[model samples]
Target: MLIASSRPLAAAFDLALVDLDGVAYRGPEPIDHAASSLMAARASGMQLLFVTNNASREPESVATQLSTLGIPAEPDEVMTAAQAAAAVLTRRLAPGARVLVVGGAGLLTAVRAAGFEVVGSAEDKPEAVVQGFAPELGWRELAEAAYAVQRGAWHVVSNLDLTLPNERGLAPGNGSLVAVVRAATGVTPVSAGKPEPTMFTLGAQRAGAHRPLVIGDRLDTDLAGARAAGYPGLHVFTGVSSARDAVLATPDERPSFLGADLRALLVAHRAPERSGDGWWVCGAAAARVVDGRLDLRPEGDRTTTLDLVRAACGAAWEAVDTGSALDPGSIPDLAVHEA
Candidate 1:
């Protein structure tokens, strides 16, 4: 492993597996400082890989989306739940094994490309039933999957995430699909995505790194996945999770490190100060020290001093999104003195 003197803990890690939707970008917009944080990590000699449980898109398409958001990434650096499911099946089952696929084209393509013979219909009584996110899933598909699984075929699912974040809001994801099949077949599927060791193992193998860090916004998937893989994780609050959630997280779902945003975490590795007298601001929200206490402003407001601090934090985070360094000027009316 490459070693650095000042940041020993950071240097110990050689690889980073980050989440896409909630951690880096939400819907079409990239999270503030998402790109810069990744670029900084890359410069620090950490190999970056985007591991996502969203099985809706292909790897190349995911790469393109990241690039469009000003994030420098490659297809090889992206691994989706669909790809993981395919890898598991390819390694375990024989070549050209007849399989029933109940999901979108991404899962079907991955499985087929991995040498599995995918059957649209279960008429052939396939050797396996692979389930993933299918927006148009109907009763017929569920029945077929149950039939195939009941026949002794291996049951596999891309992920168990109950929902996925989109522009409109959270929507039913692969986990919901797996639930339907499970209810029908009375069998639990082998999960191949986040919180499952399969994806982490596959990603680490591909990146060829001994020590890897998992970064994301959600504690359940990203942090849980890292825990399952025995790796450290950096939790950012730019997505689904809030500071309140962190405070109340169960032992297994808590993150190793928590940050307001990716850039802020990279700048300082200190844990958030939590005391009865202190005010708590989640992520990039605004806060000001008054009477030995912090008064935090709500998100998307820029009128008060707290709002200004929030805006400053937002600007600094935006700079990171564009792969730039954090500038003190980005946060207005704040004095910075070297300790």
Candidate 2:
């Protein structure tokens, strides 16, 4: 831990590269304190840069939704995977190059803005196939993409998120659709979304941030991408991952800081310190795995639940670093106590 922040995270980092779905909002609903936290961060002079894998909506649309939710954002402040995938094409294909768009209007607009001619079918002999998430996508679209890839055309997918969250529930994401084309054409697309560090770098550069901290809810994509880009990541439990997921994460998947929501930015983040035999966090809790059983020592005067939670996480992660985590039965103990 880097000397544990005495001040809030809003003052600790110059910018925050945030994820969309899980971090900011779960579909149309806002995560608790997400908007207010972002507003406070911005008020403290920290820049907000939204990095998202959802490619169906345009950046302007995403910003509009954020504004509606009380966190005002501009179109340029949002970076979509479509723009990142389009960047890959700009680096390869020349101007006027035809690329078959297998997603929605956002993707088509990106390719066209990148000086490429958008096509719908392989009959156009597109030089590449760019795929993304769109609700209207079906078997015909996947078949068209497969045909383009089979004809020796390059394939690029905005993201490979298998499940997409919405107002209803988790639905088939672009990754599932990409799998269809992959199975048919036996070709995997070059990914340009989270877990691929390139987009994070681009997002920070766009925001002109010197030291940016990535805040999100997913370990595989948001946290992993931050690590891949040589940046520190803070995990918030507003979506996708749980406390069990964090403590049990592999070396590459571990997060630097953990919190319940975006509001963690407004307070000090004190990482647990080492103690004898196990680890101590917040001076109120001690946890260790003894003979494959997780032992929790709740000290006197446990003031904040978040502090206890942090301590448990620190000890849990320390244990997992050397050995395995305790059984699944102990997972609930680490999970936050909901009211």
Candidate 3:
């Protein structure tokens, strides 16, 4: 069930650990309302840390892109999975340990900065292998990773996200490439990105935030990471997951709040209330699952579509939790449509 906050999210939380790829921008373009909403949240005294799973680019590059997209960002305020992976390696390996670098310049930069001797080939007898994502990565790089892993070098990956949202559509993420290496080597690389809690914890610690909110579009990586880090998450509809996905989310993937976009941070959230007649109500929107079918009724014209979505998710989640199997066909298309 979604949690209610009497105060606006920007006021309630000290910092927002925000995901970059799908929530703020997809590839080179900015998502609608993202920049302005984040600016407003900053005005309300909430700090922002752009936490990203995309480990290809360095922090300075990411910050430059965000500034170009109308969101002012500093390099120090951006945390990349590459940085986390480097940190994870530093904890286990000695300084100047030879590391077989896979992926792109970002991974190389982080490893070098962490006092690791970066090597290009498995024949170097590197102490470990560090892999991240890069658009140009192909068979040659993956093969090197596989070889190193098979030779008993420690394996560490930036993230395990299977798909990355780009301007065209979802593309194979680092996780897909990691899977290729794992298949050949028969060894699972240690993940240091989302769903592991490292990035979120690092962001919160840097921001000095006691009450941090994780905001992202993906349920599996973003929301799941938030749960593992002992923080609440806010899922927005601007990316991969949809309203239908939210209703069917597993217990660990559920968010504390739902919104159409980053703009929701400026408003208060009201949780759906379960009525005596088995209906879940949010404002004037009501929904229920009866005989495996979800029924949604907007009681009045004033009912917002997002509230209707909230109500539906509440009803569906309750039904699923109580041993009632919902018909997948019964779930309505609750995607937010822009005029």
Candidate 4:
């Protein structure tokens, strides 16, 4: 089981490596309580680093968008997967080496900043290929990456996220795009984003934080990545994941802390307790399996909806890990409307 902290995360950790999209905002709209809680966290002496898997834009552009969303940010405070990919590539290639750029200007700029010459095609005899995502990414760019990788240029992909949220809906992410090149070239590129520790390490390094908390909305990328990086991460119910997902999360993907929003950072975490045949949380909700069916019920003292969420997750994770059946119908209404 993940341990709880005595103090709130904002005060317990020196820095927070926050993921964008679902955590801070959805498309162009800012998430509820994200701005004010973050502002409070900063005032309480916690450093903030906006870590994004979207490499389509540069750091300055990302920071600008955050400011527009009411979250204060600066270029140096943002970390991009593109930068992580370039750092890995730079360590292997010689300075001024020719690197074929396959995605957006961000990837090119990062590679160039790392002292490499950015090229556009295999005809340039590039030494390596760096790829990311951009709306304008075309078949021509992917073809260039395939040709370069097939010709033996070392390949690197900034991220492997299969989907990214846009104004319309879910769209193919850089991971999905990278698959095309991989299929054509019969080669795989080294990934530098979530589920890999490189980006988190770089963010912590930049913030000079020895104990940094990873804050995100997705379990697969953010929470899973934090576990892979050997750091504790907090789960905010403002994005793709819900309390139900948390209850069914694999052992490795479980988050250390659960919060309704960024505001939870200001309050200390209270862990659930193991009761007779189940788990109880916040003295309001309890969960247990009876007759091969999961049973979640409220006690006399009712608390906030998050208490039930916490109880359900604690019992569900325990049951799953213990080889118990968790039928869908067995779970009651565990949704919390306030995020």
Best by lDDT: 3
TM-score of each: 0.76, 0.93, 0.97, 0.94
Runs of candidate 4 with Cα error greater than 4 angstroms are 299-304
Full-model lDDT, candidate 4: 0.85
lDDT of 4 by residue, 1-339 (tens): 546678878899999999999888888888889999998899999999999888878999999999998898999999999899999897789999999988787887898899999888899999899889998999999999999999999999899999997656788999999999999999988988887888999999988999999998888889999999989989998887776777778888899888888887888876677876555554467677666676777756454366666777777777778888777677765566543
Candidate closer to the true structure by lDDT (higher is better), 1 or 2: 2
Q: Write the per-residue lDDT of candidate 3 for residues 1-339, one digit (tens) a residue.
A: 799999999999999999998899988999999999999999999999999998899999999999999999999889999999999998899998999989888888999999999999999999999999999999999999899899999999999999999999999999999999999999988999998899999889898999999999999999999999999999998999987899888889999999989989999998999999999999889999999999988757543377888898899999989999899898877876421
Between 2 and 3, whose lDDT is larger? 3
Q: Please, what are the lDDT tens digits per residue for candidate 2 over residues 1-339? A: 312678788898999999989889989998888899899999999999999998888999999999999999999999999999999898889999999999888898888899999988999999999999999998898899999899999999999989887778889998999999999999878999888897899998888888899988888888888889988898888788887677666677778887888988888777777677565656466666666666666656443365566666666666666766467567553555421
In angstroms, how far off is 105's CA in candidate 3?
1.3
Over 4 Å off, model 2: 1-3, 299-304, 323-326, 337-339
Candidate 4 to native Cα RMSD, angstroms = 2.0
> What is the clash count for each candidate, in the order shown?
1, 0, 0, 0
Runs of candidate 3 with Cα error greater than 4 angstroms are 301-304, 337-339
Q: How accurate is candidate 1 locally (lDDT)?
A: 0.70
For model 2, the local distance difference test gives 0.83
Clashing pairs in 4: none
Poorest 10 consecutive residues by lDDT, candidate 4:
299-308
Candidate that beats the other on lDDT, 2 or 4, i.e. the better one? 4
RMSD of 1: 9.8
Give lDDT: candidate 3, residue 183.
95
